[model samples]
Target: ERPEEKLEKPCAAVAPKEEALKPKDMDRSTSDDDDEEADGYQQKGVSIDDLSDDWVEAQMKDVTVAVIGNVDSGKSTLVGVLTKGGLDDGRGLARAKVFNFSHEAANGRTSSIAQEIMGFSQSGEQVLIDRMGTSTANSRNQTWQQVVSQSERLVTFSDLCGHEKYLKTTIFGLVGQCPDYTMIIVNANAGFQRMSREHLGIALALRIPFFIVITKIDIAPQNVFDENLAQLHKIVKSNAVKRQPLVVTSEDHLEQAATGIYGKQVCPMFCISNVTGEGLPLLRSFLQRLPSRLQDSGLFKPPSSPAEFHIDSIYVVPGVGLVVGGVVRSGRICPGQHLLLGPDKVSQFKPVMVKTIQYKRVTVEMAESGQHCSFALRSLVKRETLKKSMFRKGMVMLGPELQPKAIWSFKAEARWTVGFDFSSQSILNCALVSAHFASICPAAVCGASRNVDVPVQLCRSHGDQD
Candidate 1:
């Protein structure tokens, strides 16, 4: 047997022994009253080492969390501090490490989606900055591999654009990335802003569970911080969210908040400072204990079903002609598998061969459902022609057995906002509407009526020309 399998054997054997001892321990009570009293105190604490190995193995979870708020809320800096295990220098030192483009660094703002990951061991210890002597880029890649190989759980933070000009990019991250939770960063000095409320509305509309993080507490004055906290409390307790806001101040609060995160009974708030590294340990503890919100029934499709992979990005590697990076939405994909890539400008799928598969930059033979991976495609079309073809976003790769087609028109039942009256016979021109079915795409509202379904035409762009 493999080493992992052998490790599980001892744990399974101990469970039955413990079960047998339970009855004998209960029978030894001197009297019925004593037995009842013993039962009340019979609950035992199971440490990580004492639990079954299967439980430990199942602890290797992957959760994606989206970070959002208004501009200058220190979203990128906070993420950098958490992932790199370094405190900020109060002048964009940590955030500079997260920016991918020169313009973003120059402006000190993120205009696109940036992702960083943090890993926790079985003992709930972070393992991001343990490597020694490697260059910055190499260290990051190596750390990811080490974390995936050794850690018990991984949390991926998708830092999205917080500026108003890049609101579309932020919306795409929220609707397309399928994050398990959201962390809204609020600047203590600025209090609540318009863009922050916009982000909160989107999260609430999607029914995603979220928590608030008040940043820059080290620099903000006591009065300003308290005022900001009061405003946050008022908004969270309002009729819309109706959530009880709990201020996390201790390890006990962290444990309680993490355990009840999915219950939605309370919204935990944390005051942190990336510059001085204050309250970071408590935040890390909460992340380590945060359970994945994805249920087993909703995680993946049946293995017997047809494979479907959603294409979020397309890349042309130096030697590897065309590569597509996405998540496996259903079934499994292996090297040398044949799938159909579509829907082209002509609304048809073309056959393509999977040449190679990669997971976390490590080559693998097969990738199962619910895992993000990159697949190198051996296209039947010529390289130059393939570049000119329609291989952009909102495309998919599927088993050829199940034929698929591109759709341009669909009817949806939507609730009309208050004070917005529409007539069934009137055609609403240039009405920008965002829709998400299999993928997120903007559509033009062609026609609508009160108390009835609305017809919309999907567009590749948001402009009227589309």
Candidate 2:
């Protein structure tokens, strides 16, 4: 018998016993049958409650994954196929949906940081696909709402630029966004390039757990693909990273890899073809089962703590005035709350009122720590003084209680140095430094003593601040 038939047989058999025994006996038998069926379904990886007509909403868990690689590595195409629930036409049909600019579509390259999200239901089914078996823009928005309302997990992908010229933008995406994990794509036919190595080094330096995805397997020759896979395994297991390489081929391997992903010891590699849709299901399963490392670190600030939101992108809408989008690094933010926005030319923060808040394109009254959202700000300064150029990336929106200050000089311990020839009296000026929050700015370095301690002074790079 089919699995569903077998699961329902016990329940159906117990229904006929309604008149054969006492009321209490019949109730007991029915309860026992229900329990048996539920157990059977659970053993087969199915949830009994998920099959019910009455839908109970689940608390959505957000996970950010950054996609990094070299140009033509198929990063955008893979994400488009995964989220849109459609295979590529072996051309650029899938990637066109994700390109935000006309030039990008014409050149078939991504120069800026783009974002796309995929949702998985409690039962591991993708929620973005519609009844017609295709995903449209409107359907995707609707699916996001439905998925957020019904699913237990949501995965947001930050698609970063892969070209060498846009390396700075890619670095900003990696550092400023603070993604939970990194997904590095490598073209199977072309093998790993210089930028791929650079991205991997950045991920390693940041101490973020990452995995590898080998794409374009449908076009690569069998011998060439095998050779590339062997080389990838060698590099991952080399002395530099010292990580165990695991190739996921079955469900058992996938489950074991997903469980060990947080440990940072094993690097799981997936081989997928966006055109043929091979091995995509296994990748989706791994992503769905992957746990958020932020929660594991216990670093999430309590809601009662002071609010702090890091600004990464700024925009001026015609009707919305000023809108800043970024992650809430700590605490909570709500509408109509007053906060400080700056580290201006004089390292002073100015007051601003939050007019509105948005999460995943849906307006919300409050946004909590670790959540990425956009806030519409209403400046308290005079209209003449309020200029969009005054606000730039790497600034923070902080609660007034902390009395935050933008420091020009700070001491830091050196972990390691590379390709540097510095003397004790050397003063490196106009150098760009990236901090823990991924904010990069021009600064001056001084006092590099023998004890490996250095004091750096930050200076405003633009607008005649320095």
Best by TM-score: 1
lDDT score for candidate 1 against the true structure: 0.70
lDDT of 2: 0.71
Candidate lDDT scores, in order, read: 0.70, 0.71
239-266 in candidate 2: lDDT tens per residue?
Answer: 6677899999889998779876789889
Give the clashing residue pairs of candidate 2, or none: none
Estimate TM-scores for all models. 0.79, 0.77
Q: Which pairs of residues have clashing backbones in candidate 1?
A: none
Instruction: Give per-residue CA lDDT, model 1, range 1-466, as digits (tens).
Output: 1122111101000011222222233234234544343333233212222333233225428877899999999999998888878899999888887776878889998987887888888889998656422325566567667767777788999999999888877877877777778999999999988889888887776667889999999989999999999999999887777788999999999877976667777789999999887889999999988887654325456444567887778888777778888777766676656577776555456666577887766677666566678898765433323562457666788875565555544345554221112222332444445444334344445445443454333333332122
